[model samples]
Target: MQTLSELGLAVAQRRRALGMTQIDVAKRAGVASDTLSRFELGKATDFGARKLLAVLAVLGMEMQYSLEGHAGSLESLAREHGLRR
Candidate 1:
């Protein structure tokens, strides 16, 4: 499982690889550049999921879910924790 910092790094690397600046991504994602900077820095305080998703969409990425090792299905985990998927 990648930590928030790792994920942030990956996003930053991908953006750089595509020759896109932070400002470009911010404009494309409809977010402020400072917010995007915080995300790239792995601040992880209160990043809105929808905002992150929008940013990722601009970077040609989408969120997906999967089990962690042999942790069983996500449905089972959600049921155990009273979470809805």
Candidate 2:
């Protein structure tokens, strides 16, 4: 999960898990379907953090980070932040 490819895969997986089409998420995030497509393909760098955050929100998701030397499942980190994951 350290590369754009990994990020794209995670996004795709989550999107599928939620039964959401690409167009649905793009509309919800106010981005073009092509942008979302490129994002999910790991082939674009123009998708900024704000757009990414918006898309994640639409997917009922969030970004979580651990300290560089600390490693754990994102669910665990979310729980630490008082989230149900």
- Cα displacement (angstroms), candidate 1, residue 38, comes to 1.1
The segments of candidate 2 whose C-alpha lies over 4 angstroms from its true place after superposition are 73-85
- RMSD of every prediction: 7.6, 7.5
True-structure RMSD for candidate 1 = 7.6
The model with the greatest TM-score is 2
Number of backbone-clashing residue pairs for each candidate, in the order shown: 0, 0
Candidate 1 segments exceeding 4 Å error? 70-85
Q: Write the per-residue lDDT of candidate 2 for residues 1-85, one digit (tens) a residue.
A: 7987788789999999999999999999999999999999999778799888999999988898868846867887787788995
Model 2 TM-score?
0.77
1-85: candidate 1 lDDT, tens digit per residue = 3777777888899899999999999999999998889889998676788888988999998777766654767898788788999
Checking candidate 2 for backbone clashes, the offending pairs are: none
Question: On a 0 to 100 scale, what is the lDDT of residue 77 in model 2?
Answer: 75
* Residue range with the least summed lDDT across 10 consecutive positions in model 1: 63-72
- Global CA lDDT computed for model 2: 0.88
